[model samples]
Target: MSSAKLSRRRVVGAGLGALSSAVAGVSAGCTARSGPPRRLLLATGPEGGPYNAFGAALARAVAASGSRLRIVPVSTAASVDNLRELDAGAVDLALAMADVAEDAALGREPFTRRAAATALARVYVNYTHLLVPADGPVRSLRDLAGRPVAAGAAGSGVQVVAGRVLREAGLGEGPSPARERQLGLAESARALREGAVDALFWSGGVPTPALSTLSREVPLRFLPLDGYVGPLRERYGPVYTAVTLPSGAYGLAEPVGTLGVANYLLARGEVPEAAARELLTVVFDRWSDLLREVTAGARLEPRFAISTGRVPLHPGAVAYYRSVYG
Candidate 1:
């Protein structure tokens, strides 16, 4: 095997071993149940984003795999909204950003109390996009002050990070604050094109379809956000990391540095162990299909999937990881 594969194997083995201790004495309940395939509701993002595409693909893949779980993807505002829905028993599964998930798990702002959610996997990294018109006067993060900007839909993870970024750049406080507009990807793109918003914030996999389409229609410039990663980590822990949007994406002339946040596949803690294991089995088996829909280059590796930070793993997920490592 290649050195990389060997190293990955070592990491997975060690990580699983460490995680096994946490799940010890934890009951996974019955592994056998008899009935028609159970239908599950999965909360995803807006229509044109990566979360929506990936959720739809995952649901189709689960059906095609002949699993006993029937996943039904539901479109939502994404992240915070998804977690809130899951908490309310409105959804069986949800896709959420690590930062927002951490907030929900810890009972932070936007969440009045701790949430009962656990992770199945760290699905992928969301690259933050601060898009401005090529001919627009906004040259940097500082330039966005006192300007109209689409900061993402109200209940979305994009909004969570956008607010932080804007504040870190000293735009959302005191006088001369940037005018914040709450809009989803499609609406934000249209607003930007119409000169209604000076810039827009989006957090998703590379070459997000709507943004890619918008780029073809208008010359675009992406502002670099690497400078804020350090401060974000300092204030909010290590959930934020520096990432780069490659040059070829959205017709960029060069690579742009940006913030990266992990996206997690979350489940309510009450989900049956058998159902969770079966869901993950199909997901890992058909992960390539999900990637084809979500992004150009992303992996569903077990080692990376198990690193969900403060959000505990679902017992079913822990069982699945143990089985894989063993």
Candidate 2:
């Protein structure tokens, strides 16, 4: 086998071995308690997005695992909305972009006060997508100046990154600033197809379903944003990374460079330790199942999951990881 395939198998095998040990430890130490299952509201992204799909799949997987915790997926505006809902005590768990979560933790722009949110795991990475028509006049970031662009839906992580990217490109607040529209992924794709907007921004898993379908209907192109990663990291810490959208996605003839941000599963500081631990137990045990609904090449390995950067991990997650690594 090729070295790449062999390396992937080694990683997967090691992760699964660690997960098996963790599960065995849990089973041997815990005793059955007779009671109603604990229900948790997981605030996910809008319909058709990776967050929403993964949330639903996770709920099913947890249920199938026979765990006492029952996760209910609640669709929201994604990242920022998920964080706000988590802070408001409206949800027990949420999925958010690391950058937006950091802003909430630090009480940065768009957040009035610091939030008491804790990370369960760094689940996946989202690629920044700057999409335009294959035959449109928007050949570069400069071409977007003074043009209408769907930035992202209000209270979404995409909006936070899109604004920063545009500002860095000098199209945010200049003589010819790009007109911004607050449209969700579905709406933005439709708007682009109908020529209502010149370009749209999205941050989601590779080959986002909406964009993939839109690409089939109307030829689309992804503008490279790799150049902005360095500047963004220099200004906003290390939340952004340079990544590439592999060729063939959206029917691209060649790979397109872009910025990537990690996505995290977060919980309110008040969630019970037992419940938190149980939820993550199932998460790690059923990691492969969760990946089916996430992005291509996604992994739920404990090493990767624990790297939440500045966002503090929940105490329960800390305990769980200790058990896995110990």
lDDT of 2 by residue, 237-267 (tens): 8989999999988889999999999999999
* Top-scoring candidate (lDDT): 1
What would you estimate as the lDDT of candidate 2? Answer: 0.84
Which sections of candidate 2 miss by over 4 Å?
1-33
Error (Å) of candidate 2 at residue 82 is 1.2
Backbone clashes for every candidate come to 0, 0
lDDT of 2 at 18: 25
List the global CA lDDT of all models.
0.85, 0.84
Instruction: Give the clash count for model 1.
Output: 0
Question: Per-residue error at 106 for model 1, in Å?
Answer: 0.2
